[model samples]
Target: MTSTDAVPTTAPAPTEAPSSGIPDLWFELPPGFLEFDLEEDSEERMVRMADAVDPLFADATPEQKLSLVVSGEYILQTMIAGGAEHVSACLLRMSDGKLSQATLCVIIERPDVGPESQDRRGTARRTAVQWHEQHPDAEVALIMLPYGPSALCIRDQGLQLPGVLFGLDDPIPTTIRQVQFCVPLRTGPGSALFLFMTEDIEHWAEYLDVVSGIMKSVSADEPDGDSKPAADNPDAGGTESQA
Candidate 1:
């Protein structure tokens, strides 16, 4: 497939962040990458991301799981509850051979609770919406949150999606198609990845391959190939969980 050795993962590495570089796990970047690092947990791999998802599938058999290493409350509190900070989001497309399944990913830093309180979730949605709008040729929705609870919510919601999300009252906490995964950030930040269009499941592997390619290219462009742990502070939080 075709790819470029450009751009970079946004979140900088914190003390607890891993330095192994792109991991050998199921998800990976492409081969032509010059520099890249893989941690056990990536923020772009969360659940709330699904809120941004649109009509990507008819019905998907979702998987169930949980990550208690760092409770969502704890992560949120540790970061946001502690004070103010910046968060980053990402947009990804799962290539389904001829068609493409688009997804949006996000990474929140010091996420106890940000200034965008009323529109906290909106912050992420807006970012994803803008990306899709800018690239109308691409798919819509499919949002992801690098935060922990968002990941938990991804699996929680993905399993009961489609019909269960009609009420405008609650407004579908997870409007996008999202999935939760473990990240290597301190306390291993939680991550969410939303998958728009259940039809893409038939071509999941191929689409994932495209994602892997992009990830590799991003890593290759990293200045150090990977983020190293901080010497002064061992539990320095999630610095590399950038984007």
Candidate 2:
């Protein structure tokens, strides 16, 4: 995808209604990603996570559990503060037995005007142009997805969160690179869904491919009970879920 070129496309397909209230769309995420339930309160979410990870932490001491829960709470608070409708973490075990992880956040946006007031394709093109104008160095391209047109932006140097988020006292902040795709949804006028992923630069290439595959798998309709998770499909990269 070039900086200013629109990738070739096939005809657009019809939009699907969101299965849930907050997220008007559904997509998938690769294995190792633990999706947080945004509707639940922090305490409830913590309990959920604890239960999910109980097997792994079955032998943990009281102090270890306390420290881990505190850290988890901080991360959850930050994600909620950023208006993330869907939040997930991809944790992998490195060769040396160390843990490596990345994060993906999805935020759904609704148009302010009436549905008839805006054109989906036009809005996507405008978004691409505006992003280029604001960040000339960042790579921007207009691409066609199965559902419709979208604006994809890649920035090597992305947002840096404060150290406090990780319970660090150092003045240096944590740096992360981001790949974002703004997909215009047909659900409403000027409505769009943004998929933002942040990861270490070393794993950028691998994660980019993963995110691209996830974007390609996005659909308006939720998957039926018979549908297989991405893990079961060798060609697919993520598990179907509402976001």
lDDT of each: 0.29, 0.58
The deviation in Å at residue 65 for candidate 1 is 35
Please give the distance, in angstroms, between residue 181's alpha carbon in candidate 1 and its true position after superposition: 3.0
Worst 10 residues of 2 by lDDT: 1-10
Candidate 1 backbone overlaps, count? 60
Per candidate, the number of residue pairs that clash is 60, 1
- Quote each prediction's TM-score: 0.28, 0.68
Model 1 weakest lDDT span, ten residues long? 64-73
Best by TM-score: 2
Model 2 residue 133 CA deviation in Å: 1.7
RMSD to native for every prediction? 17.4, 10.3
Task: After the best TM-score superposition of candidate 2, give how far the Cα of residue 240 lies from its true spot, in angstroms.
Answer: 15
* Model 1 lDDT per residue over 110-223, tens place: 345423232323434554556556555444443232221111222112322222223334422222233322222222222223221222354545545554333323211234
Error of 2 at 76 (Å): 4.1
